[model samples]
Target: MTISMDQQQTLGLSPNTLKGVHHIALNVKDMATSRHFYGAVLGLHELTGDEVPETLVTLVAQGKVANFRLPDGTILDLFGEPDLDAPHADPKQQFTRANHMAFDIAPELFDQAVAMLHQQQVPIDHGPVSRPTGRGIYFYDPDGFLLEIRCDP
Candidate 1:
């Protein structure tokens, strides 16, 4: 099966207005650690997750599994206490390390993100360098996961 979506903003007709992704979820070793990297360091809004435990979170404490909404319909989810590496039986395990995810943020928002990362003492990688598609900033999460933040083309 194949699905096609063109980034078109339609006002009427059997129209289609497709944007970016809705969300992306990742695994972590610990909930608190994940929260620190994603919520504290990255400035993502801390929200309550009903399924998440309450003992470890007190409005300020690092909590499990949270979401960060990018400018587009892109949402980033950081989950915890799950497997970090692939199963040992998988033959393709050696080739999966290249996987990564990117977020679409406005240029102004990118500036704010840079400032926020600096405040958190988080190191940034490459620039707000201009690309044919958009401006982007590359950085690593607390777990050394590469993340790219870009804006509209």
Candidate 2:
């Protein structure tokens, strides 16, 4: 699956221009629950206004947006809209599916993470399934966003 320089040029992408994820944004039904799940259960530290640039205030104001920093320093933004009642497509269903997000975890911590999720009584949608790249578990957030925590093989 390696793409050569010519192929990358044709695709209008260069490796040097590509950087890791800066942030991942999510829309949820409840701010408190989302915060507890991400901050308490998942161990992502909530970032305060003093930590983020003031320029993002407007963009983050669409809902009760709260930003958190992952262990690796990546940002995860949660937007809570209590009145958002639109039906969402089920992640388990392949048709008309929305994208799912996966977080990388150390291989040794995979089992521990699974145990923690189980202990917290989070619904496990599917897995500890083995893939070519690693082992992963698909689980739901309080708002039903399908999320995965995986360890590289």
Error of 1 at 1 (Å): 54
User: For model 2, how does the per-residue alpha-carbon lDDT over 1-116 read when each residue is reduced to its tens digit?
Assistant: 89797865655422333234445667777888988999999888887767753545655565467889988787787767677554645646454223357677777777877877
- Measured against the true structure, the TM-scores of the candidates, in listed sequence, are 0.38, 0.48
Report lDDT (CA) for all predictions.
0.56, 0.70
How many residue pairs clash (N, CA or C atoms closer than 3 angstroms) in each of the candidate models, in the order given? 0, 0
Off by over 4 Å in 2: 1-8, 57-63, 86-153
Q: Which candidate is the best by TM-score?
A: 2
Instruction: Tell me the lDDT of model 1 at 28.
Output: 58
Q: Looking at model 2, which ten-residue stretch has the lowest summed lDDT?
A: 12-21
